[model samples]
Target: MSDALEKAEAAVREASTDTAAVQLAFAAMELAKAAQQQAQTVPQHHQCEHQHKPRRSAGEWLGIACAVCVGGVGIAFASLALAILGGTAAIVVLVLRSMWTDYQRKGR
Candidate 1:
């Protein structure tokens, strides 16, 4: 019974050693293959070619001009409204400046 036990223990140790050696061999082969592939690959360079587009149509330009005119009128009306509210634009500016200063002082 003791002899059988000793044989089983030796067999287990031999199998473990064989498995470790096989793993090391496979790892070495994989490393060599990777190195070979890295050495063989070459990088590529490319140049970009950009194309220019034509200008907008007259209708499109007119639309943009109209939009700008509308924005200007809106700004004018807003200024007028602010003036009528306090009888002067300076009052609105002073109020805005004071609010900003207070906000800054509060770290908000």
Candidate 2:
């Protein structure tokens, strides 16, 4: 099916000398090997007839929002207590923002 293979076959047929036939055979083998390697290295992608995943439900979003709000309120009270006891509120905000950014990136 390959042009190189077709050309090599033609060359072999036309070759009068043993050396010419051997050289053509070697060329064809190399071409076949390269093609095989390419097939192995390249990932084969198949298209789906539909979407990969169903959309998230509204109830799921509401539940997630509720959990987040509860956790956030708890953290705010904890961080306030820590700040009152001479801890750094700025560091808490920085760490929480960094974690949220990482979570957003991973979700995408």
Candidate 3:
């Protein structure tokens, strides 16, 4: 009976140790699967394949050109007024026109 009990105890200990090892192996497999999934899901940066789109249509260009001509005339009148008023208004008008030209060039 004592020998039989010892054998049963040894068997239980072996089985418990085997269960622990199997659990650890399962955990390691889960970690490896997670790492593989993460590797597969990683995003890579690639060059953009998009093209530039123009902001204005043909009709828009015509309208913008007309507006610029009108604005130039208005600025000329304002400059004349500034000249008569005897202040820096003429300089301001010139600066504004310069900025407008720069803006138009950049838009193109």
Candidate 4:
């Protein structure tokens, strides 16, 4: 940037017309100002691109496994209870229907 600015200064001094010299000087000043600003600016620290996650411990995994087992057992018990309840309901319905037919035959 300094080298470019020096070249621009030389060009402006060697320019024949005042108008051309003034334009070249203005351009050099803008370049120098930009370089100064860039130098004064602070550099930013780069962060890791990937996310950081803590790994699960063995105890946590064991706890999760135990919970899954308990859930499975609970579901099994619920299924068994539903089967029993359904069987009992079917039996009650069959008994009631049989009694109804018997009563109707007796009335006839």
- Top TM-score prediction, candidate number: 4
- For candidate 4, give the lDDT of residue 101: 98
Q: Which candidate would rank higher by TM-score, 2 or 4? A: 4
For model 1, residues 21-86, the per-residue Cα lDDT tens digits are 999999999999999998677444443457768889999999999999999999999998976987
lDDT of each: 0.91, 0.87, 0.92, 0.92
| Clashing residue pairs found in predicted model 2 | none
Error of 4 at 60 (Å): 0.7
Per-model TM-score, in order, reads: 0.39, 0.33, 0.41, 0.54
Which ten contiguous residues of candidate 4 have the minimum total lDDT?
40-49
Q: Considering TM-score, where higher is better, how would the candidates rank from best to worst? A: 4, 3, 1, 2
| Candidate 2 lDDT over residue span 5-106, tens digit each | 999988887775778879999999999999999878875565356757878899999999999999999999998898776656677888999999999999
Candidate 3: worst-modelled 10 consecutive residues by lDDT: 40-49
Stretches of model 4 off by over 4 angstroms after superposition: 1-47
| Clash totals in order | 0, 0, 0, 0
lDDT of 3 by residue, 27-90 (tens): 9999999999988887765536789797888999999999999999999999998788766767
Give the RMSD in angstroms, all C-alphas superposed, for model 4. Answer: 17.3
- Residue lDDT tens for model 4, 1-108: 999999999888776577787899999999999999987785655545788899999999999999999999999999999999999999999999999999999999
What are the per-model C-alpha RMSD values against the true structure? Answer: 20.7, 23.3, 23.4, 17.3
